[model samples]
Target: MRSVFLALLVAFFATGVAAHVARSNSLRDEKLTFNPTNVHVKRLAHTPRTLTNAQRLARGLNPARPQLRSSRRLAGRGGPSLTPTTTSTSTDTPTGTDTTTSTDTPTSTDTATSTDTPTTTSTDTTTSTDTATSTSPTPTPTCTAHTGVLELTGGSYNGYVSSETNSFGEYSVTTDASEALQVQYQECDGAVSYGPINFKTLNGLSTYPYLGGIVGFSSSSDNLASNSPNYVYLGGTQESAAGAPPQRGANSFSAASGTAKDYESAIWSVDPTTGAFTAHWVNTDGTSSAPTIMVVQDAIVLTDDTFRFIQTYGDAVIVSLTFAESSSAAVPPQATSSA
Candidate 1:
């Protein structure tokens, strides 16, 4: 019985050992099948694959053992090689168009020096004869009682205070007739400044023609000498004329500005018979003085009763005469009457 049991145990041990050995051999076969070195391919020859005909022609070299380009060619530093085996030939010739270049130099010189400084001198010079002046005494007009008279009220800016008449039978005047014919200047606040008076004669009758002209003074042969109308100019201003209150009675001569002084008056007349013209400039200050500086002109008569009477203040034409007989006359009369 002991020998039988020992034999059975030995058989079991041998079978177990054989099973373990078979599992070990299977694991070793799997490890060998998955070896990483199996994928490595070792080169046997030095040459690469055969080159195509186009590749060989493009490289200009034999297909067998073709030479590689140098590093300079790879870096685009070398020009194309002109080998004998190359079928294509090329040559480069530089070309350019004609060019022109030009330069200009300018030379100029401009110099200015202040030889004399500009001056703001008054145009109203003492030697200026624009206004009538007296070198001798002037004879004053004799005072006479008249009927036909025109009184032109002249004050500051308030209002006119005078009478209007076409004949000497209307009123009477002595030496203050010039004051009664006073007129406020067009400027100076529209007569806000007290202006001087004026004296005028129309036909043979007494007439006060201030801003406008008179009519019926025309006669035959009035325009025989010339077509331009006869004109009379009176220039000057009263210093109290501007910015002065209305003071109507003060006539005679007063303080004035510009070239026009006190009693500076002029008269221009045209003969109705001969068509002749004359001017008389007087300093109405009752002086028997010869007009040394008379800026007068001899003009021909224009239309019948049509004339230009110019009154200047400073350098401006403040008033002009007009005739109602002519259409071309400027600033025609406000009213007209017969002589």
Candidate 2:
């Protein structure tokens, strides 16, 4: 009987060791390799696997069998809970498809950059264009052209053709016969009547500068002096031969001769021999007054065929006096040339 009891004890010990090993293997499977107490193993070994609790008690064993503790419980009591520390080597294929949806940030940036560049370029272009336009220049105007050229012969007188107050010597006009014509001013103390009026140029008269058109034997050459040919004063007094009273306030008349003399009267007439002529003037004065009349020393017979004289009064040259003639009018002086 004692041998029997020893054998039984040894078997029980063997069963406990087996159970402990089994539990250890199970724990290992669960990744919970925590060691448990012998008492825990004994309890697992005595746990009935096939029979009910009543049957086991009738079999003369403890009414309640020892229960095997779960590996999770054992781990909780002995050490850190070994849940499948399954580092689920989820092949950390970090499926983090680093889907870095890098939105087209550079595209927007490039568009803005391009826009800014064009603005700068446009500004520079506009500035350059404006500079060019501002630096340009304007044009100037020219003078008008002339009508005709003329020559002086015998008889014909010359008329005034400028608004400027020009006179003999400084600027002068003569008859066709080279006789110096004068715009005479007579200080008359009597009532005098004038002769019939005459129109010289095809276009009658000019109202400005002088109210009446010039009355004399004027050559067509003098009419081309300026645009409006009307301002002239024939410095000579009325004579009896011109159907005018020779002297209204004086008894006799003396014509002007010496230097700086003012001829008082003159007469203009058409002769059968001479086309237009100026009769000799009479009654002269040499005094210079506040508003002095034009005085003459001598007449200027043009020597050059083409003569150009600039008539000026105050500021600007009013008329361009140009004289051109035919060769027939330029007769050379002979030994018997008339004076």
Candidate 3:
């Protein structure tokens, strides 16, 4: 029985030893199979299984490897190289030059002089003498007296003719037995040449009294040659009072002088051809009244009955008539007459 028990104990020990040894071998085999470096090298060197066309066709996948480009070929084609390139440059400087020159010169000269002189001379003389003679006196001047006659065949008028009828011409103011007052220019031939101009028809003359006298006169120096006189002068009193008898008067060289009334007076100029007349002047200025008309030399003179000068009308009042002197042989003096 003791032997059997010891045998059983030894068998138990041997089974434990075997079990440990088997466990150690399993560990060693696992370590050898699972080594990291050897496993990596083996994976690197090991060829992977590839799919065939038939196998790829069966799995619906491409069988060939994908063609990929290189990095440079992917960047661009025929472009500039990425490597940097360098360049070298050079410069040159020039030189300079300068030149100068100058010169100057001057000269001058002057001269001057002056002089003066003068001289004079004079003379004078005197003498005396006397002389005398006798002379005669101057003589007095004389002029020839001229004489002629003025005749009138007409009769009984309201005015007068000059007392000296022998003059070359005569003038009178009268009415020709009509209401119209007439200025008669009587020639030496006993013919009336110019007038009997009706003073009643003239303006301003119509209201006056009967004209006292009329004279045909001119400014011309030659009287007896021309028949047409320049103007005829009429002189008379103012309007007569209501009861006065027409202030009638008549005078002649013969003994037929009649009495009349004279008062305020006026003067008029008359045209012989057309019987037109204008009142040239008036004498109602009462300082001197009663103007009797007459021609003396070359002017018409207004006077009192005594033949004293009252007023001279103008040089234009000279009597001019168409007539022959009574004695043609007698040289006429400056032709004077009166009324």
Q: Which is the leading candidate under lDDT?
A: 3
lDDT string for model 3 (1-339, tens) is 999999999999999999999999877545432111221111011112343555332222235664576656555569776765433232222322111111111111111111122322222222334557877864432212112222222222232222211121122322232222222221222222232211111111222323333222221211111232222223333333322222333211111112132321223333434323222222223232223334444223333331212122222222222111221111122111111
**TM-score for each prediction?**
0.15, 0.17, 0.15
Error of 1 at 6 (Å): 99
Q: What is the Å distance of residue 268 in model 1 from its true position?
A: 3.5
- Per lDDT, what order, best first? 3, 1, 2
Q: Which scores greater on lDDT, model 1 or model 2?
A: 1
Alpha carbon deviation, residue 38, candidate 1 (Å): 99
User: lDDT tens string, model 1, 17-73?
Assistant: 999999887774444321112332221111122436453322222335547776564
Error of 2 at 180 (Å): 15
| Cα lDDT, all candidates | 0.25, 0.24, 0.28
Cα-based RMSD of the predictions, in order?
Answer: 64.1, 75.0, 86.3
TM-score winner between candidates 1 and 2 = 2
Q: lDDT for model 3, on a 0 to 1 scale?
A: 0.28
